[model samples]
Target: MEKRVKERREGLPELPNAEKGKVILRFAPNPNGPLSFGHGRGVVINSQYAETYDGKLILRFDDTDTSRKPPLPLAYEQIPEEIEWLAGFKPHLTIMASDRIEVYYEHAVKMLKMGAGYICTCSADEFKQFRVAKSNCPCRDNSSEKNMQGWEKMLDGTYSPGDAVVRVKTDMANKNPALRDWPAFRMQDTITNPHPRKEIGSKYRVWPLLDFQSAVEDHLQGVTHIIRGKDLMDSTRKQVLLYEHFNWEYPETIYWGRVKVHEFGGFSTSEMRKDIEAGIWSGWDDPCLPTMATLRRRGIDPIAFRDFWIELGLTQKDIAVPLSSLFAHNTKKIDATAPRLSFVRNPDAISVGIDADERMSSISVKSHPKEDIGMRKISFDWNERGTDIYIENEDSTANADIGMRLKDWCDIGPIAEGFSQMTSLEPATELAKIHWVAKGGASPATLMRPEGKQLHTIEGLLENHDFPIGTIVQLERVGYARIEKDGNLIYTHD
Candidate 1:
């Protein structure tokens, strides 16, 4: 436990620009899918910075791209729950882009009237040709009045999905072609792919693009800083164009590089959703996906996630860590609390004929070895002759010379091939001490381990186990496990 936590002895990076009780940071994630480790790292740093400065943290859901990544209604609620679970409190504010479409629309109109934007009706193919030539679209020189008419047509259902779009005016000859006449808003046929909000229910067809919507909301919400990935440097630049157009100050920004968590290569929530729909995955909380929901379901403590990101600190270098890096942190938290239990997978019987009932009752072990955690009483029921001790298959031996001991129980010699025999009770001296269930009301169990996004089940029996569901236990020789709400035992990790 000490080793997992003590490596980070230095202090975290200071937010020099943040003022006490005045700094405001926002974690703006698109609500189109579940949050990933990449998304969590951004939000955790933003929230931590907010706490470090005694300021406010806002959870703003950027749900603008309904045409491509439609806003998942469940995510709007789950995202906040996850954030609160991680930060240990509710954010100072929660804003959804869907709820603030009017504000975005107002700003887009303001830019149009300021002659900083125009409506371009160029076909995608034609726009590509113009972009390649570094030439302006035909409508680039149109008056604000004509652009206003096109915008009205886009909103009032007069335009089809691809008929018209609002473009923020930028250099046509810009080296980065993406900055040339970037589209600020576009027409989407909501009837075909509707927004999930039932109240809105396809009422609006003109939607602001993500870059445009976030810039407007940031200024309105008094955001002091932006924490995001270096891949989004282009996004920051795009938002800056609108920020400058409105004479709004761009917030101080800290950009991090992409992180690669091993065992999750090519993981995508959108693709995972389609796979889930096609029955390729179990579901979002499948214990294999890197989503927060899966992490929580697998009994991953939220504090581990917090510490994991905090330890990563404010480095811009891309980090590639194994799943064990996270499990190590989680194990430190649970090692003291998880009770010790014995599970015999594919039971191999070793019949030890003991002397008396007193010897049979000598086996005892605590819930946790050194901690003050409660203990589980272990008692062995007697057959007509003696006690029937059941141990693991690999631990059984046919030789009577080599001594073996039951864990914290009694020392016993292995019986011969055709004879059930007994040895004198002595202090255990063998190097191999095996765990066993005395066949005294041991409960039938199945340990489910997640092996590369698939479930690997071990049919087994747990010894001296009488805990209710949801009780986490360390299966003596096996890894830690959580008794799920469904009464199934699922392995957390070593």
Candidate 2:
């Protein structure tokens, strides 16, 4: 197996060095659960672009809203490990978004002082109906001093979940709901919180929204480029506005389409997590699912995945590639290096009679017809009753017409002819394709199915010697096979 670096990169944009040098790329996956194939697509593209531009790849865990964190104590540790595994050790650093709560609070205060944000006491029902009726919050006209007092109460836990929320003072009449004085922070109730931090207590009621936290984090960390799904494209614009308000540079964005709704069967992450907890799948890595761990277990070659997704390039059109395409690409990759072995899966051997006197002879077969050198050794012997030789049923059935040599020994054509000459120790002309192993055969062979099963077979002699394990060779007329031990064969697709 040879390790090769990528010769060309796809989905890379043409930007001047001036533009690229300022780039600091990040793959900020909210590790609420194990990442799926869609995440894999994003990861390779993000890392590839970073590699191409000689920029940094930061692995950020946007683990805010601690209430939704996985209940397992080790979930935090597993998140980074999974990210690193899928990204292939390319991230320059790993940072947790939750660790910067103080930073977000500071920015929240700054926005308040600048009169860019205010507090509201709208209940859930009131807020929903307000939006439907195209009306504004009554607190929308509250003075900054009063709003500040509300925020202070929010921080002191005076406000219950949804008792108060702080929203940016954006236009209420904006057609886009996202821009309608969107809530920057809101108190979360227990029903919405799956695994709230117990030790942290309820000292504070306000929690930053996803987009707001992400916007501030990107600017604070000097992230100059943000690649994400188009679903977040609108957020990018809002983030740009936030940066403007803070007098900071906005990161260039490359937004691709989100995974199709049908692809997910309309199952959200929350649903998937519930399914996982209920044992619907094996801890998010079950091979049945498209999670990265499952993909790897199913024999998918990550490099091929990277190449395929990158070549599709980046586009805003939502599409779902069949799982077959990925499996096919991986099969091609494995075929290039995975050695072939021989094994009779169903265990049907051609039982042909061989004579007594010639029992001690040898057969010579090419180790690998594709490669030109080594040979496998095989010998033949009569049973105590002086009769049969066993060979793979498939080889006999497929090549019955052709009398292929059993290595250096006589060619055995078909089973009928081979059995017809039972008395002679020589193989029948029609049974020339018959493969044989000596009475005391030698060679280690592993039989494998797509599911990684091993098969055992008699050893063959090449140049009067037994073949050793890992002896990749052709069985004269048989398909490619690898000699596992001195006498066993493992079947592979080659």
Candidate 3:
């Protein structure tokens, strides 16, 4: 296993400040939706660094906010599967913020007693005015003793949703407006957005914001480094202040700019949820979406996804990467193992007539021409007449009585509408080379290819349907495809 990881991680740039003791990292994701290719980067980088230092990796589900970004039950399990698929390793630990509610409460009380936090009952509009004016609110001046009473009121059900919150006492005049006494905890409207975890989601009304929860978890979980997107730099800054207020040292942090995959649209968990709920998408694994499930279903090698990010490394500037390059990388890894088959899309047929011959019953053809991928045999069941075969319209000759070869099968007369076959196994050198599949030897196959923002279905037929479904194969003259268990296909790439 160690050697496997090392082999997959070769040629990566050295991490900065590599000597941190017992390097511990955590990939804390909110379980609102299945992870996308963008999430793959964080999983691979953190896992690689942890392995590099012989440390541990944690999969922490930051599921505190059950109101706005409510958790999806499937996301809880789907995320880890995606991570393991991309990184080829499992996390050593799994944790949920909702499970650690009591711990956060204890920390919140401590902050309240320390005078670093206070309970504010201001309405949303009032807080916006205070933020715009860069001024303090009436709650900001409350003593710790008075704040303690308000805190009790919050816990005793005296405060309704949006009626009160606990805010950390940051500088009111800080240059960044977000830093000015941000709310630490708020009351969730459990009626509108019920918690996903029926056992505990609705049990608590007051919850810590992501900033406070993440900061506390980092310290308590023994995290040594934080790797995240540059867009979250503000989050990093906010967490730093929490670390300071608690008189604790902050963890090492690294931020990289956003990565744009040219083939996919941007990601949004809420948007995905809305689409799924509205039946706009089949599911997270729908070919039109770039979610990990869809990518896996397309027969893409996980190693290809891992290498793409590792080679890109941690850069400050955002990158616009073409998805074709990733397909190119995956092809190299699977070309030798991916078996080949014959597929005729929009098939055109012709009946070749010939005399009885033992050689006409079967023919052997290499699955892959240049590689030692073995071979497949195509057979004809009859001899009185010639073999009936089908070919993709695009690969068919427009003229009849013209000389043509039936791919690895046999020599044929001109490609026409009726049955006509050659008496010999040899074809003229000038015969047109066209892909053909013997009738009844191939099964109906449908290929779903992803377009800009929708899925396009193309009907076709595969010569060897006996191969187990879910097998990844290259259609001799066509692109690669992953056969569905039912014999359909999801096109990977050309």
Best-performing candidate as measured by TM-score: 1
Q: Report the lDDT tens digits of candidate 1 across residue range 1-494.
A: 36565564554687767789989999988887778666778778888888889989998988777767888888888888888877788989998888888888988888899999999999888988999999988899999899899889888988888898898898889899878888888877788887888876687889988788888888999998888888878888888887889899999888887788887888886887778779877877776777887777777788888888888877789889898988998998888888898899877666667666445564556788899887777776666656776777676753345756777766766555522445555555643677878676477788888877678889887875667876778898998988877667888898
Q: What is the TM-score of each candidate against the true structure?
A: 0.94, 0.73, 0.93
Put down candidate 3 lDDT per residue, 303-368, tens digits, no spaces. Answer: 988777887788889989999878888898888878888888888876778766434557778878
Q: What RMSD value applies to candidate 3?
A: 4.4
Question: Which order, best to worst by lDDT?
Answer: 3, 1, 2
The predictions' CA RMSDs to the true structure, in order, are: 3.5, 7.7, 4.4
CA shift at 473, candidate 2, in angstroms?
Answer: 14
User: Candidate 1, clashing residue pairs?
Assistant: none
TM-score, ranked from best to worst: 1, 3, 2
lDDT of 2 by residue, 227-266 (tens): 7888887787677667777888887787778654232345
Instruction: After the best TM-score superposition of candidate 3, give how far the Cα of residue 338 lies from its true spot, in angstroms.
Output: 0.9
List runs of model 2 lying over 4 Å from the truth. Answer: 1-11, 15-20, 66-75, 132-134, 189-205, 260-269, 355-494
